[model samples]
Target: KTRQKGKKKKKNINLNQSKKQSVSFVCLTCHEKEEIPLSVVRDFDLMDDGDPTTPPMFSCEKCGGRMYPEYYEGVHGIKYRLSDIL
Candidate 1:
């Protein structure tokens, strides 16, 4: 992994709207959820700001599958599912 040093900028992702400081990552294949700090996520551009259909930046450690963010809506209390497009 390449390490870059500087101030980490925050994106417009809805994680800020929540009280929790961290977000959850779900493995596409294994269905395992891992709650990771937002600082770790800021290291890379996981979600494409230009396109919501873009894939995530990281891969699963256990199964080598793709890892995507699990976005939760606080108002209606719903989780948005990341769809896979072939």
Candidate 2:
């Protein structure tokens, strides 16, 4: 029974890892809509309050851009253009 529970837990973990995230957002640099992957969400444990559920940084695969996942309050999510990286 113990071993069965362990396997079930592992399966649940895998299910969470297997989740694919895709959202369309305009590239800050190019001003063109791009599909960003959820897997690209990276954790900044030190930068944040150690909340892994909410990833703080995301990179744009198309333009090699990085920005915060801010989409609330008065400001919409800030998008970074390729030039912004420099």
List the candidate 1 regions with Cα displacement exceeding 4 Å.
1-19, 46-56, 72-86
* Candidate 2 wrongly placed segments (more than 4 Å): 20-86
Question: 1-86 in candidate 1: lDDT tens per residue?
Answer: 12322222233344454537666878878977777665565434343354434423468888888877776322223344555321
What is the Cα-based TM-score of model 1? 0.48
lDDT of 1 at 63: 89
RMSD of 2: 9.8
Give me candidate 2's TM-score against the actual structure.
0.28
Evaluated against the true structure, the overall lDDT of model 1 is 0.56
